[model samples]
Target: MLHPEDVPTLREREHGRNLEGCCGPHGGTGPNLACPCGSLVATLLADCLGPWEVRLHPLRTWAHDPTGA
Candidate 1:
């Protein structure tokens, strides 16, 4: 049985596999594991050694809001 908290919220549609699998089988995206972002947020949180926070900055505007126009 898998724990609900042991899963990564970020998911990739293009990749046939989930983020959890990339980290390692049954590893549940640990901080020590290599994530798509190349960070170890998962492992730190899982081990309860420290808190993890990720901030995403929008680099570019690909689309415009049609409703605003």
Candidate 2:
């Protein structure tokens, strides 16, 4: 269920990890996107491997856990 509207954003996030030697031996990018958007993109990349195997590691928003407990 990939959409043209999201392709650009997902691709941009992937490119963020193209730091050959600046970061790690194998640069890394995160799929810390919002809700279903991030999950979908990660699955698509993992299944297709068209660019990178997007790993889902979404950030915890205060809205979801205001107590932070």
Candidate 3:
């Protein structure tokens, strides 16, 4: 999981059915964010009553350590 601000490439889902929340997206319906290429990649949990975070789909995502650890 990562902060939404950390992953600026993700865009809000086109539809609202997956973005139900009190203040922001609840991300309960499934992946509520997409890549610039329109690929569903993560679920953004920004609901006021829940932990604010973005859960990336592992199978659909890649990790590159800039520090080369």
**TM-score sort, best first:** 3, 2, 1
TM-score of each: 0.19, 0.22, 0.83
lDDT of all predictions, in order shown?
Answer: 0.34, 0.36, 0.89
Model 1 worst lDDT window (10 residues): 53-62
Off by over 4 Å in 1: 1-30, 44-69
Angstrom error of the Cα, residue 28, model 1: value is 16
lDDT against true structure, model 3: 0.89
Q: Give candidate 2's TM-score.
A: 0.22
Question: TM-score winner among the candidates?
Answer: 3
lDDT of 1 at 38: 47
Model 2 lDDT-worst window of ten: 19-28
Give per-residue CA lDDT, model 3, range 15-39, as digits (tens).
6668888899888788989999998
